[model samples]
Target: MLYQNFSKTPVLAAAATSLLLLLLLSSTAHAEAPMAANEATEVVISASRIEMARESSGSAITVLDSDYLEQNQVQVVSDVLRDVPGVAVSRTGGAGAPTQVRIRGAEANQTLVLIDGIEVNDVASGSEFNFAHLMNLEVERIEVLRGAQSALWGSDAMGGVINIVTKRGKGSLNGKITVEGGSYDTHQETLAINAGTDDYHYALSGTLLNTNGISAASEERGNREKDGYKNATINLKSGIDLLDNLSMDLVVRHVKSDVDTDSFLGGVGAVDSDDNTETEQTSGKVSAKLDLLDEQWHHRLSFSANDTDNTFFTAGTESYNSQGYKQKYEYQTDLFLYSSLTNSDDLEHRFTFAAEHEEEEFYNKGFSTIDRDMDVSGYVVEYGANIDDRYYATVAGRRDINSLFQNANTYRLTFAGWVTDSVRLHTSKGKGIKNPTLFELFGSTPDYTGNADLRPEENSTWDVGTEYHFNALDGYVDLTYFHTDVTNLITGSGQTSVNMPSDAKIKGVELSLVLRPSDNTRLNSSYTYTDSNDGNGNELVRRPEHVASINGSYLFSNDQTRLTTGVQYNGKQDDIEYDANWNTSTVTLSDYTLVNVALTHQLNKHIELFGRVDNLLNEEYEEVLTYGTKGINGMVGITITGSL
Candidate 1:
């Protein structure tokens, strides 16, 4: 029942109507493609591993630059992505809790995450990324690509990809420092330094965060104890010009965190006790880039490694503990060839060839019967072209050889072009895959058992969209319709895991808008409508039918002061609830709305002050069924930017 039954709910009806308006508005517009407010063109990679202008990007992509992140006072990586269309985010509890990122209704594990050029997804688990500890102190930009990307990125790209690019040093010496404090006994400190000369450059940063947070469970659940969290992060980047045309660089990141948690069994929230967990992640990448043929040809070779260690302690048991660790390694090479097209006017072609080999090693004292090691190898080739400065096309294919699943092939074809000066159209289709995790395929215990016979989960996705650029209004609007079909989905039935007999279908429409009415005023809005159902036509869990967000900000005092307001609305969704007997049942959570506000002012060229208030209305809402959310909390801080 794809959108046919949305008339039953008033909110759904309104969303459907808005989608139609978006279609009509974009289809009829004529004039010129919208330009960025800064009037500066941006270059992006992640679409095909080759840099291209944003307007020529083949996939639906969103870029969050440093300025935007700063204006929003974003603390974590997930905060920067909450307003993007076609994406969904949920957390189990407070700041240090686990977070799940979903794109276009696909499962969380079906998404791939990258830091610079290194993949951060835990291969031994469900291939999911935990954003709780991923601070944003040193990040320069974040790129989010929505759709099936496995054709170029391999497994776990079935939903999409998130590429995090950190800051790099250039030119002269400079530094920044920030200190913040807020409700719930929260405090934070950040420092960043950069220095460079013609031959060498370096950037270094660190962050310290501590908070005596609210309860992990809802206040009404009779849980009164607080769960505190503390974390420290460090990032270092260095580059050297070995020769005029060749450069070498290294990126190192480390994070350590401790979190106090609440234990809940059978869908009930228990009070916080001695249940605490500590995690440490260390990752590094070393690479060399060579420019040949007057910078027309580019070659990059990189090697990266990521290691994580975690320990969990139970209440009232000093001798009982569980620990796990993972080590991942990757080697990659990319070669790009750029050439001009003779037949097409002012057209350019970029051909890319890439190869990768990765290995993952995991050990857990909590699980005794799981595999300890796995390996995968992949190869890819892609061709992308910009035709006559208005048309863009891309085609790519990949082959992945898995240790347990033998081999899989993936491919993609995408295109984008301007229908008129102001109206643009885009569409793409791709294939993706996700292999079974160690717990799903090898676990054997009284409460749960694995299925060695399970098949790899595979999917095909397609999307079409139109965008209208309103140069006069200084804004743009986009509407996209997407559909995904997945087969061999693995599910749990009681104590055992098995593949579903049929397939699941997820279809949705997304609408996004950005407006800069004045030189110092900006507004952003997005809406998403999703219909996700299982093979039997039952609504899937946590896939909300409607999600919307709107944010507006204005700068005064010659752009030295800024004030922002925001709102988020989340509609009802289905979730699973377990009874005391361990029986599972579906439940629908109520809809909710949250409001937030922020203020910032510059005291001088070297000093600035900022404050933020989240959940301004103190609305009691939950992203996860039973997890608690912060209410009516505020933070104030000052930033120092200058030559050290």
Candidate 2:
């Protein structure tokens, strides 16, 4: 009995290595074709509250599908999490630059970006979220949720949670269009549509991207003073089922981007070059579900709104603009119970309760402008259990109150066990918080000064895992280990009214695998080992201790053409450390391993043809901290789907 009523240890070393990897994956299932059953797809289970997969453990999860984002035409969501497994992405300019990402090791406003489930984090950068004005055109899937979720979302989430789910209405009118161009002058365009009418459903998407960056320090000729970027996006969604238990859904999104850098001149005067940065955002949401006094009692309601604007230019020393707004309301309930206590067998339990209210406002202008407003309230309760299919348990708690600062509490505990039927085991622990951003407390002008006494940044996390599934073959595997400890941790001493204090620690180990090995071919691999330390030992800049990725896919004729390839590695790092007065020199950055390939052809069921090649050994990297990251590129596209 796995995890039967908390932990008492058992599970015989993960059930004898999952029966020896399911007998080494049953001699390779005739070489391919399987995994196509699961209620015909469509899973959005936000971690422990139900819905499970990715082998299921309790923490550490990653999922990206939509034919792998249309066979890698990925235009955001940070390029599909850049091979997951302890993600980290950085960019300074190309497709509208200003992109930064992090997970596991946290930092990037401590991770927490959501769409559909709302919360886009960014009210004067309290937890960073620009996402270059969002663009992934009506996504259909993307869920990371690695660690410390504050019991179901609260504050910055302390480092993990990316949920983004879009696209509804399945069956009937479908659509697609794509275009691409390569080599520093890159160009892209996309459009999508989906519709249904059994009770009303809809989806819409639009995208446009432009690039022109290359050299920042390569003898400076890859496009001198490169400055050229642009982006645009629009998304809309709808749903209605009017009766039969009542239902409704709606969403709207908009984005704009622009960037042209060249500032902070040390050579002085005239060389100040050009500078312009702009961003605009809009968001809306509404949700309702009811079945009042039946089916275990159900009721759900939601409302949301978000608006953002940012502008920066320096042609004459002072030009800045900032604006932000947010509003939210929510309610939830669901309960089901039946227990007999006494460990080891099956019982029953499912309970949930939720309530939330939020409001935020901000304003700024020029060299410095300030104004503030905030209100937040929260509550959550959960319990889940299963004693007989091999054991499982969950407990959750959360409480939040804020008018400005301090007032947080979070808790979570989870256990899982299977021991047989393919093995399973899980463990989780949590606590989280983050708050402080409104330009870090007034001052976006006035020469920068506004700290209205700030405080609020804490975290604690622990996770352990194991998973193995093989109904005789079809392969699957997972392994996880995590630890996080953060306190205070907020920095911004690059000038402007200074501020500092950072204490951090992150531990990690992750490995995942998928294998078909033969009916055509498929093999995936992942590995990550991180230490991320900086509580005085110095050295946590541009982190990278080890990272790996491997991917392969193959399918032919009778199965309709397919080919995929991947290889990524990052190791050497330390972009800047040693600050006598403030980093008095000591920079090292040497680490590169890039290879990517993709090809798809199906010209049959409605046309298809694709191609991709990026940094295919054309290595020359720099993920930020001096910018510049590009070399070797290629793209080809074609797509068409039908059914009207």
After superposition on all CA atoms, what RMSD does each candidate show versus the true structure?
A: 11.1, 23.4
Worst 10 residues of 2 by lDDT: 1-10
Q: Name the TM-score of candidate 2.
A: 0.31
Off by over 4 Å in 1: 1-39, 267-271, 316-344, 367-371, 443-450
* Per-model lDDT: 0.77, 0.68
The residue-by-residue lDDT of candidate 1 on 226-253, one tens digit each, is 8889999999999999999899999888
Using alpha carbons, what is the TM-score of model 1?
0.90
Find the candidate with the highest TM-score and give its number.
Answer: 1
Tell me the deviation in Å of residue 607 in model 1. Answer: 0.8
Give a tens-digit lDDT track for model 2, residues 303-381.
7777878777766344778777776676665544454566645365656667676777888876545777777677778
